[model samples]
Target: MKTSTPVGTQADQLQVTEDGKPLDAVRGTRAGDLDLRRTVLWWKGFEEQVVSRQQELHGIGEDVVLAAQAADTALQESPPRLAGEVFSAVAEGFSTVPGEVPRLLVPWFAELARSIGREVSTRSLADAAGAGVTAVQRAGAPPAGTPSLLDALVPAAEALVGAEAAGVPAVAALHAAYRAAADGTRRTVEDGTVDPGALLVAWFFERGTVV
Candidate 1:
């Protein structure tokens, strides 16, 4: 993975090789001393001396594929984004570039926008649901999933489990009546389970059915 030094011009090539020999990789070998700098005069001399230097050293002496690979390497070595950095970068890219593009890149931008929004939206929903649950608990309302009478209604949910259960008036109205009665009474009955898990399930599900 030894790359030619970073000389971005043609003349630099000949000067680097003016003695008419290839590089001696061993001469500069030193641990933790990679990406070393060459003398300015060396670079200047290379710039003045080379004939096909830029092309010769184009992307570290590699061809087009090598050039692309070098670019990819550079990109890999580049810093990674912080939490907001990527979004900001992509958003800026999206804002600035508003036209047809390389086919490979379109889905990238589209997916970024979609995932970002979806993540944000899902995060918001989770926060809201959490807050809603907390609020209900604080208000001493039964949790949202089932009604307070859920153990009383497990027989109900199972009895009227499927859509066909919807046709059973007794089963259907059973949930309806339970909900109706529960909705009317938030008073924690002295002997009753204040807010059963089943209660939340029943209220949310049955309420949805009725609506």
Candidate 2:
């Protein structure tokens, strides 16, 4: 629960390749590239919002749903089921973004959410991310019913948020990478021609959308 947590992936099976790098929240990801690119400034934007603020991720508004109530028309991040709270909470507060979020959600991310087959108009942010993630695996198909996306990353987000809330700089840096991967995936899918399912892992790598 403290900031001493080592960075890892949402899925227990997947691992982050930190290489032999120093985890510095103040400096941002040890990423060698992407810092020089112009079209994409999110690397730094995310760093400022999330990574640099890692010690505060826990304070990221646990009321993810309560805070998003007015913005979220459907889902609520209530007890026993706050797993997918990101979707609803984000929907409720996304319009006032940056300041509103513990970490920044992807900007103009709705279209990509829809691309991932999520019902953007209805689901919460956690749910939408879930849908986006699921869409890629089903070959661009939407989930049949209640299968949630937040369900996949919830624990990781929570764990990372704990570090942020605790004020751990290094942990925050890892969270920034996660945001970059999330947003970058959305940017790439905007092309309207990429296959959602095919680019699952690419989203985490900041390749934009996919091949």
Candidate 3:
């Protein structure tokens, strides 16, 4: 249940990178580049509010519902048995996804909603990063959710660093990147867009893979 060292603890590095190279959190597949230091800080500051924060993603919150509904509809469209498995996974809090992968559920579902031709709402974009930042940070360490979360986070934080380097305020870059990754308003990672669901399965959840 212990969490790994947050990303920012390195000595005087301007940005965090993978294999000594910069990567994008929203887009990068190999490494998570989101600033772990900020993520940890944000999580600690908001833990009291988000750890117990429970709202049906997109089901009960603002326009996020449209995104949530789209993901649900997409799941329903899958083969009945596979759909059932996905639903079961959801019910089990993404137990099979490994690490702090579950913390990304809200964002992943929101992004999945976007992938299925639904529009990612502004509310969903903001809420996902806001609440999700705290949620991921609150998870446990390696073999639990923390390591995975931290791994996933590397790219996300790196993306924000890029945003800031481009003159975006440090305070606003995270939300902006999260929104861009979700809505396709802009590219946060190198590949073009972010797919939280696929990322979970292909990168985080699946074993012997990128992680």
Model 2 lDDT per residue over 1-211, tens place: 1122122322211222123222322244333222113112322232222222233223343323232333333333331132223233333344444432312232213323333231111122233344444433343222322222232233323433444455544324235435543433233222232122112222222221110
Evaluate model 1: give its lDDT: 0.29
Q: TM-scores across all candidates?
A: 0.19, 0.23, 0.27
The TM-score obtained by model 3 is 0.27
In candidate 1, residue 208 scores what lDDT?
Answer: 21
In order of listing, the candidates' clash counts read 15, 26, 24
* Models ranked on TM-score: 3, 2, 1
Tens digits of lDDT, candidate 1, 168-190: 33223334434442432232222
Candidate achieving higher TM-score, 1 or 2: 2
* lDDT of candidates 1 onward, in order: 0.29, 0.29, 0.31
User: What is the C-alpha lDDT profile of model 3 across 117-179, one tens digit per residue?
Assistant: 222223323333434444544443232222233334434434544664565433344444433
**Candidate 3: where is the Cα deviation over 4 Å?**
1-74, 77-118, 121-123, 141-147, 154-211
lDDT order of candidates, best first? 3, 2, 1
